[model samples]
Target: MSERMIRVKDIELCTESFGNPAHPAVLLIMGATASMLWWEEDFCRLLAEKGFFVIRYDNRDTGRSASYEPGRPGYTFEDMADDAIAVLDAYGVKKAHFAGMSMGGMLVQIIALRHPDRVQSISLVSTMYFGPGWEELPPMEAKVEAFFNSMGEMDWYDPQTLLRNAVDKWRILAGSKHPFDEERVTALAERDIGRALNYSSSFNHSYVTGGESYLGRYGEIQTPALVIHGTEDPIIPYVHGEALRDSIPVAELLTLEGIGHELPPAEWPAIIGGIAKYAAL
Candidate 1:
């Protein structure tokens, strides 16, 4: 069963943890503008059944963990990283294997850099070392704006409409070429609305080089790591996959051809397998 709490400045958080406590832990870090529900129940359970103590939760600004404070400066990724640390602390865990997707992937980089001892291994999926650029590849501003627009037109204030909007966004991000379970996404968005941020700070951090200067800090990470990305990812070019692999001394890269941004249901077996294999060592 999933549990919930208010943490780090009274922000609500929803948590789902299972499997043998004696087994190694796996902490899942989600992507930008995402909630814990997006983590998917089947995925989490699979990890648990695979002999892992799996932990997944909603970030402060997403899902049941949200609270709006306009005067509060949009939370920085650094602080967000700290919040992630707080989660581990709350659970009384000294360390665990971490697997992050997109923005969540960036958070692991920070943890591996700033709190190396707290991480057993790293798995980065569809994430960039830094922010996406207009020159390298145009930001998905239009699609994101369209998401906002569709919400407004559907009167997002209504819970059901907002859920539909959230589901649609997931479908689109999945490229809609693959089968997506709308019911799951809808429930995720439903829980997500309560944790929605009207003006939450996102992806804004002081970067001397890029958001994920983990490249420079790579040598500090003494743990094994893995980098996974889709070959057809338009948001972050496959070059990042190569870069992350090249930078981390003990990292391996897995490039999936034709896969889009989101992890599809069809690939869960391989996804869980890859992680279980790495965490074993």
Candidate 2:
């Protein structure tokens, strides 16, 4: 794998790629408050081994990307969506398949609607539909809600405290089906915190503003889509995936039974295989 920084507008985004550029490109966009590291290096390599040019990048305010004040974010979600395009442009990839998790999935939806020509396909993971009818879906799980509500109490400056809170957050997100791997999660949290330009800045994602409403436009998307959702997902319920599959003209759902809002290593093979099949089409 190789890493590089690409300038987009006034800020820079750090990106990493695996496999040959000649292969079909598959861009992986992680969720809010997460850097590209969340994609997991071994997972990327496994996907690349399936003959794809896999790419993962840090969203602004995460990893080595541009950051803003803790409570203030200079850009909007629209800008973040465009940043994905900038990554594509920088790599000379005119069109590529996109696999996004959570907020990243929302960005993929926006890109497919706003810039249809640049997208070949999209894989939505642990994310809800951005258009109409989302309000009627199941709300966040109570435990998950409580965890997010308590985030303000965390002392971001204390490494140990941050690590503890990060692990706790993952424990809630991993659901009951799988055993919580505290050591693994802790190591990843440490890596994320240690490699960031300003780890606290990642919280700026909570303040991002100004994205044009995609209301009632889910059917407008023409690109083929794969909606992957964990049945036990606390953040985005399984019904959201069903909504996407039903609303989009060319979309299908892949349910992960007994899974939660996370992409655990055991699920990588299934997820990667699903994406590879969709990309081939």
Candidate 3:
């Protein structure tokens, strides 16, 4: 695997890749406030072994990438979608299959909507489309809310506290069937903290303002699409995935039984296979 910084517009994205570049590409987009490492090195290698050139990158304000003003990100979601396309252009890839988790999934939807001809296939995992009543959606599970709500109380300046909060948050969202992996969670939190340039700007992700709904455009997407979600996902919930599947005319839905928000190792085989099939690899 190799890592490099690719310039997209005015910002630079820290990107890494696995397998041969000559192979069909599969770009993996991580969720909100997440770094590319969330995609997991093993996961990328698995896809590469399945005959794909896998690419994963840190979205702006995360990892080794450039940082924006704290509490205020000047760009919009459309710009982030364009950043994905810019990454493709840097690699000289005309088109590639995309698999995005949570907020990343929302970005892929926008990418497909804006640049339909540049997408081969899309996978929306643990995310929902924006609609008129999206803001009025029911509150998250109590434990889930409590877990995230605790973020405001933590000291962001203290690395140890941040890591503890990160580990605890993942533990709460962990699937009951798979249980929690303490060692793995610890490693992930440490890696994320180490890679982050501006840890406090984590909240900037939620502050991005002004974006239109994709609810009316879902059916207009011509690319083959897949919606994968854990049956027990606490963050986005399974119903959101259902809504996405129902909206996209040619979309396929894959529900991982008893799985949660995080992509555990058990669900990878099905998720990777689903993306490969959707991309017709």
Task: Identify the leading candidate in terms of lDDT.
Answer: 2
Per-residue accuracy of model 1 over 1-281 as CA lDDT, tens digit each = 45747477656566768777677889999987677666788899898999888888876556556544433435666777777778777777889999999888888888888788898999998877543332464354466557655543565346666566667777666643467777766666665675555413221222212333543466667888888887766566677776777778898888776766788877777778888888887
lDDT for model 3, please.
Answer: 0.85
Give lDDT tens digits, candidate 3, residues 1-281. Answer: 99989987678999998999999999988888888988999999999999999999988878988788788888888887888888889898998999999989989988888888889999998887565456665546899987777787778889999998888888888778886888988998899998889977756888876447644478788888899988888877787777778878898899898888898887889998999899893
Worst 10 residues of 3 by lDDT: 131-140
- TM-score of the candidate numbered 3? 0.95
Cα lDDT of model 2 by residue, 97-160, tens digit: 9999999998898888878999999999998776676787889899999999998888878999
**Lowest-lDDT window of 10 residues in candidate 1?**
199-208
TM-score of each: 0.81, 0.97, 0.95
Candidate with the larger lDDT of 1 and 3? 3
Roughly what TM-score does model 2 have, to 2 decimal places?
Answer: 0.97
Q: Which sections of candidate 1 miss by over 4 Å?
A: 9-12, 70-74, 131-156, 175-177, 194-216
Candidate order, TM-score descending: 2, 3, 1
Q: Which candidate model has the greater lDDT, 2 or 3?
A: 2
Q: Which candidate is the best by TM-score?
A: 2
What lDDT score goes with residue 149 in model 3?
77
**Which order, best to worst by lDDT?**
2, 3, 1
